[model samples]
Target: MPADFHRIASGRPAAGSTSFEAQVLPYLDAAYNLARWLARDDADAQDVVQEAMLRAFRYFDSFRGGDARVWLLAIVRNTFYSLRMKVPPDGMQETFDDDAHAVVDEQPTPEARMLIALDVGALQKALENLPHPLRETIVLRELEECSYKEIASITGQKIGTVMSRLARARERLRAELTRHSTEVRRHDVQ
Candidate 1:
């Protein structure tokens, strides 16, 4: 290895220090958003992010020559899966009924509605309705803005698999939004 590599590598402040904060803080909200989307609970999401950060700190040295976002997200993904595996089989299953959902109306801005129109909480519930792999792919690609290669690395799947899952996730989300809109219309009709 080139001698300059050591200085470049050691350029970052000590692990878990202010440097870690500088690097990790900006991504915190996004990471938590993703973790919450994946884990489906405030507490569990917090736990996942905390664990991910710790793991990232511990493994910071191994993160040579790669996108930090992907590295951090891979840790987050692993943390989510670890927690997911602990849930009981029955507790892990989710069922979504097309007939029961409502469509989302994107027309009204918050200023127009005088209230937050899009129920992010409801949308989050809908996202949680998806299968784990699909949910992970969606959160990483769409929410976290990870590229195909990054997503592939984080999920330990091939790029093609990431692309496929993202496609499926988009389709599922569209269907879900449509169902939600339909349900809203049904309620309006009644």
Candidate 2:
């Protein structure tokens, strides 16, 4: 948890409502995970989480007492998009794909599955290489283990869109990792 988390928890909600500590603190790491992957930097991730925490505090009263994790995450997602508008773009540059609608969900090769299971570094690099939408979807669904409905809530997209993104993300990751695994094997044969 950030140092700000302790101070932020001081904001007491009304009687019968959950405290900030009880609500958002538990998911701080989750928020950081989402932000870190999205921002693609430790420093920027911290900044994004901090701003998100603050926004959650400001609107803490508005929380209707259901799924604080999802609610806080929605705020974090919004905060990231908001920051993108204010600041210049950073190193993570994935062009928008116009043909995402046409991407067929494909099964991974066995080698791709093995790579994903065994090669954490390669998997991480391939995941980072994905487009932001795909990356975020994978991170949210795989890393955070959010339900499609929760993902839709946090991302403000329909469940179908979330499913589509997750499928696309997985397929792209499979291709990248499979290609990498093949290259590594070729090198070993020499």
Candidate 3:
């Protein structure tokens, strides 16, 4: 067996006494991915991930047996929202149409169709375009596949609020994805 596992599984220091990289580094990518998806920008995402990792390390002794993913996600979510609220708003908030979200929900799109034809790059860009609340909800619920309760706990919102944000996020994402698909097709044909 590898030396690192022997140390961690044996409840001893791994390799050195300085830090538990064996126990923590494995989850680093997951932390960064969740943060990036939530922040929707590389620079901000990296910042969140670094800060979260430091926080995690600081409180590592308190973590008992449970889902580390959720624990880490909660940290990322908190960090992202704290930073999000500090940014000055532009006028685009009016573009988020709650009625449009409701309409989209009443008529669900086929996932199979999206999976077959959707452009991955376009999907990434579309996600980046969404408002912070909508984007964060979608990232946690859909991309991260978090439960509604988990999302609520992370965001400190009611379950109903989590559901609503997720719905609106989906609607905006769908519209953006559809528009991107059309643009890509047009570009391809030209």
Q: Name the runs in model 1 displaced over 4 angstroms.
A: 1-18, 87-122
lDDT, candidates in the order shown:
0.71, 0.81, 0.67
Give the best candidate by lDDT.
2
Model 2 segments more than 4 A misplaced? 1-18, 91-118
Per-model TM-score, in order, reads 0.72, 0.79, 0.63
Q: Order the numbered candidates by TM-score, best leading.
A: 2, 1, 3
Worst 10 residues of 1 by lDDT: 1-10
Q: Model 2 — TM-score against the truth?
A: 0.79
Model 1 per-residue lDDT tens digits across residues 25-141: 567677788787676666778889977877776676676755666777788888878867888755534443333443445787645442233345447666877888998898888
Error of 1 at 21 (Å): 3.3
The sequence of per-residue lDDT tens digits that candidate 3 reaches over residues 1-190 is 1343344344445443234354566667777777777654567778887777666665766767466677777877777666667765441122323232222223436654443334554566677777777887788887778899888877788999999999998888889888877776787633
Best by TM-score: 2
Per-candidate clashes come to 4, 0, 0
Error of 1 at 66 (Å): 2.2
